[model samples]
Target: MPANLTPQYHKAEEVYKQAKTSEEKIAALEEMLRAMPKHKGTDHLQADLKRRIAKLREEESRPKSKKAAFDPFRVEKGGAGQVLLLGAPNAGKSAIVARLTSAPTQPTPFPFATQGPIPGMMAHEDVQVQLVDLPPITPDYFPSGMLGLVKSADGALLVADLSSDLVLDDLETILAKVSEGRVRLFDPAVQTAGAPADSDEVLLVRIPALLLANKGDADGAQDRLELLRELYQGRFDPLVISAETQEGLDRLPGAVFGMLKRIRIYSKEPGKPVDRSSPFVLKEGDTVLDLAARIHRDFPEHLKQARVWGSARFEGQAVQRDYVLRDRDVVELQVDL
Candidate 1:
């Protein structure tokens, strides 16, 4: 089968050619990869693109000449997962971060108060989720490394200021800017809505997004939110919040955790009690074997049967390696000496 490349892929290729910086080139290449039709015909091309991308990333990570010294975008991901706070200028992105985490935020009435990416840990029950407050994105101005950061995040919270009548326009502008990089935002209901139902030829990064209508305490905020709901018509389930008032802020962490779609698994030694404080996080529907492999490199090859505690039919019940693990499940692996 011939590789039926789309117009979007060709556009990305053009951008890649015109890119002046390594980061810009990488972003364009990634956009190309996302836009390319995934088929056997493009498998080799995909592999080659991936190889080039890896090489570029490796080159960028290494120390270069004295002129290229600092890299501000290199954020080490921590906690359960990283969630990006994204929106147009002064959409309350900084305010939201300040309310949720201890990270110092410059939340003023002025736009573009945040000039760099700021990561903060938001506690969700026993675990912590990394939330990065990114510079506001707009059609005229998007930070060079913003796309990469958004693409690498587990999920995103698209904030809109309910106090302003331009809220809907701001939301649309943000979406358009992201889409130009081949990234699409959708809720669970419209996950597959962007692609054609009959074909698998589409290439797009469909990110799970939560619409946050901030400044809920503002005058006429309720009317704005109602209009927003009517405008989107269930496409985006907007979460009304007041970062200053702390109203609806408590539920933000839980909503972010749910968007991550990850499960927590506790591990135990032969005779020791399960360490409940720290959990080995895995994507939902992962198997016991996956947890074993994560625990140790040799566990998968030299392991025997395993016993389960939480989410098991019985306490300490023996389970095979293929047993599907559940959230908060405690696993005790018995490996052969």
Candidate 2:
């Protein structure tokens, strides 16, 4: 049989060829692999693509040289997923981080309190999500470093200061500046496509984001928030929250976790008790093979069947390599002897 490829694959291949960064190349290659037809004719090609992907991934993860000048903006990702808190000064990004996690992001009565990126783990039940309280954005002084952070994050909270009448103006300022930096923010639930990509000087990233109307506890804040929503109707769906009084905060962690679009899986040795403490975080719709890949790069190619405790018809049911996993699922892998 002849190997068939899709237009999507061809398009992604072109993207890979023109990619200037390892991250972009990897993304394009992954898209190509997903679009390519699988058959005996494509077996060798599949293996070749896999080898190339593995090599690029290794290069991407390799530690940087110690002698190189340190970049203050670069933050190492941690926890279930990395989320960026973006907004204007005194938008309560710091307050949100302080209340959610004990990150010491001292929120003062004034603006620009958070001068740098502070990564803190916010726990919800068993899993922890990483939230980075980044420097504020303003009309004249938005941090250039923050655009890069937003592009790399899994999600973002575009916080709006409800206490200020110029909340809509702040939103416009944030959007305009970020767009100039080749980054676009959109609620995945609101819109599908984004503006066209820019030149190779920067890679354009469209991040899934939620608008947060912070400081809702303030007087006349609700009226201002209503106007803010009306002005940006269908553009951004804002979530009303009061960081100081903890109002609507009870829903925050869960909302953050939901925005991440991730699921946690627990791994177990055959005939051994399941270890639920350290769950392996995986993207939603990930399969058993993905979990195997996460465990070890070689495990995906190495042999065999897997058993599932959760998201199964019955407990401890045997599943195939491509078995789609669910949140909090327990998995046991059996390899060739």
**How many clashes does each candidate structure show, in the order listed?**
0, 0
Q: Write the per-residue lDDT of candidate 2 for residues 3-78, one digit (tens) a residue.
A: 8887666777787899988877766676667667866576567657877877996775567799976666677888
How far off is residue 94 in model 1, in Å?
0.8
Q: Report RMSD for candidate 2.
A: 3.3
Off by over 4 Å in 2: 1-4, 30-63, 192-203
Each candidate: RMSD: 6.5, 3.3
Q: For model 1, where is the 10-residue window of minimal lDDT? A: 193-202
lDDT string for model 1 (1-337, tens) is 8999997788778777877777667767877877788665875687579668868977865766779746566577889998888888878898889888998777888988888889999999889999899888887976557877776667889998998888888888888888887677776643533532222223345678888989999999999999989987767888899988989999999888887888999999989988998899987766787787778767877778899998889999998776889999999999985
lDDT of 2: 0.81
Residue 336's C-alpha lDDT in candidate 1?
A: 87
Give per-model TM-scores: 0.78, 0.87
lDDT of model number 1: 0.81
